[model samples]
Target: MKFTPVSGSSALIGAVLALVSSTSNAADLAAAEARARGHIAAESARTMHDAQHSYAARDVIIDDDGTEHVRFDRQYKGLRVIGGDLVVHSHADGRFKGNSQTLAKSLRLSTQHKIKASEARAAAVAAHGGEAQKVSEKVIYARGDSPVLAWEVRVNKAQADGTPSELHVIVDAASGAVLESWDDIHTAAANGTGTGYFSGNVALTTDLVSGTYYLRDPSRGNTYTTNMSNGTTGNGTVFTDADNVWANGLLSNTATIGVDAQYGTAVTWDYYKNVHGRNGIANNGVGAYNRVHYSSGYNNAYWSDTCFCMTYGDGDGTTFNPFDSLDVAGHEMTHGVTSRTANLTYSGQSGGLNEATSDIFGTMVEYYAANANDAPDYKIGEKLYKSGTGALRYMYSPNLDGSSADCYYSTIANLDVHYSSGVANHFFFLLAEGTAGAGMPTSKTCITGNKLKATGTASLTGIGRSPAAKIWYRALTVYMTSSTTFKGARTATLKAATDLYGTGSTQYNAVAAAWSAVLVN
Candidate 1:
């Protein structure tokens, strides 16, 4: 019942062709992209050789006042440069506000590499014990001071315990050594066949080919669900029905779990599309697919950016339940959201933020759906418990889990990214609901204490959940970098608040107070 240990950066690392597609914001975004492109081209040409550096537009944002921010992925020569991502900022009147990038050094690394692609793949497979599916050279700055020409090798394999793994190994092309490696499986933690057992009776759109209904949503970019047949590999068969109605919420039926997964996927898609204006996971109209009943008794769920899909598992019947619940679905899919925006490195504070982002959005998706069968709450995996009590993690007070920290400390980064997420979770709770109001979720952590204010007040104020969510969404899409830390989050949220509600607004002050309550400052 835990979503720990996997980092999703490698899954999203590559050439990204993200452009805002909403018709309302289309013309404004195009102009913003053009201005930012000119700035990037001028800077690169003036500084690094004639044209050694280039950038591809990823995401664009234009505030109500016409202030704009454009995100880009940097390229050295033809190779994608990891951590060389930058955001182009401009004022409402179109004056440049300079570029915001994490890469501090000049881009002048030699693209030539001594190691052969075969050799790099061999080394990667030897280390991880898997077939080499892909091996490409890239310039990586996320791991070191100077940009490194490294081999991005993806080994197709599963962990020893049968957990599906796409081990992405970064090998130094010069040193022929492993730079870093992480599993690409973004798990939420597990299923059956059949309208959903968990989501209540819901409406669904299916493709009717020759009167046979295919389990696909044509409206939401043909988003579909498949049965994994309890296998650890393959894309599986897409669910089809003789009748338009899929199934009742019955685990005995093979597609019973698929119904829940299908319902969950659609809800998450609607949440992002309507609430945050994200067209899809990548801000394109395309939808990420879902796979349910994965690998017999596999108690987990995950989103794979490489496959652009979500996978679910049936609980072992002891610790967890089928992980096709609404919030869990939203949690896993938000990893895809993080992949597209910010691309937060899956280590240290950045990784914690990545996990926290999923939790925050996942919880919001629950509230957004307002599902009657499943009540909205701050507890993740609350409904997925086999015992039907307790939760995977408590957002109001992370320390309730014994591992997650409710307060930020210098060494908090030493913990797993999942546990380190506690502080941000606490901050978000305070930002959305205030200091544990009567009858609201209570915690035995710092929020209940007087640490939030200098005056030793026991209570902290909150802006409503919707406004808080909007601020976080804006901060994530516009200001956050791959390496943003807790302190950096404070700056980003304040900026987002100012952009949305103005500098001296109540929402702006609430963001500051929430961070202060969590000791981020």
Candidate 2:
């Protein structure tokens, strides 16, 4: 998550200066500095006029190198803008060099508020199909050429999946039209334990504070677990014990869920460090904490970037149990990984890729753990849905669940990200195990439900799971971007495979064939 300034070499400075001319005069520079120093309202009008852009300064980061990155949130006619944030780069001399923006165009828009704030809130709640627990309003520049002024209505409530949902519903202020809406709760699902629901009869790492042992892992970045007492939010109370022994096979014991959460956290940390050389979720050697026993009758788990923590829910205990399984933990933690890296936007094709990244890594983490109780497979949340021997999603044949797509199609982007992720999941499975069913339990199918016959022409030989996972990790960290599409994913993975195993090696060929088999091309 660290944004290191590019070295201010002559060549780099020249390149940057080429893209941006010095638009601000000395007075403008002073105003910008004043704005950066918290005189935002005082200098807002003058700064926007001088810069010829309606952007409000959000952050000013002065790097160790003589570079200043002034982050700005765009505004249109005195309203805040979303997806229109940009960072203006300048030399130590305050010479504006260039800027980076998520916005695609200028923020000129009709500021007439045809739709009232209450109407926007009602529309957002109606879209959510629930009572809004909280609502806030702001103006945003919707994506595309000539960004339009829209009301960014933020709604927070409990979703059907047992996770608290933060939804951003963008309503056009001038036209009273719904521009876009997306869920902000990035749910996958998490972990610890004396006896995990999945990892049975296991020992837990604890920290002795005063006379009690706290549910903290001393070996893994001091990662710990807390009991939410069946509530929905907040950092719950940390489990403590007079004796070192934690859970005792009692489902009613809140500490039992804590055990599964803590153990899963430890295993996920090990999986990243040992398998991928990643330090932690952010790769900054810092461990993320966990909240267990979240909400009564809850049945989902989620990782929150805002909280820098993961939350697990205690299921209804009949069809589902506590969301503290190993693979679930891995899956949720990988969401943190995706947030740090690529940061794939949580909608459309990129969202599918984002979800798939977590599923792929989560499965690998389970395999890497090699825990006998939870045998590693291409199934996600399998332990959570053991009552019917079903899973949240299946990587080998995603369509087996009757929701996820097994292969890509022209309208794949229209599907829910959880379902669209099937294409990439199937691709990863094919890349690791091959289309011939070698070392695999079964063969795969295309989107058209065509049973893939393993003939010599269409058969493929895999290059092993370890290499496949490494290539994917490399692609995610090095090649992918925020707006990457399925086509871009193909190119990114191809480049990663080429970088790792050469241009025409078996690994590279397998990656290409796998994507092709999944209809990505």
Go through the candidates in order and give each one's C-alpha lDDT. Answer: 0.76, 0.70
**Number of clashes in every candidate structure?**
12, 10
Per-prediction CA RMSD (Å): 6.1, 8.8
lDDT (Cα, tens digit) per residue for candidate 2, span 201-265? 77787899888899987777789999999887679999999898888757777788788888888
Off by over 4 Å in 2: 1-122, 129-149, 189-197, 386-388, 445-457
Top TM-score: which candidate number? 1
Give a tens-digit lDDT track for model 1, residues 267-294: 9999998988888888788988988888
Q: How far is candidate 2 from the true structure (C-alpha RMSD, Å)?
A: 8.8
Query: Candidate 1, residue 294: CA error in Å?
Result: 0.9
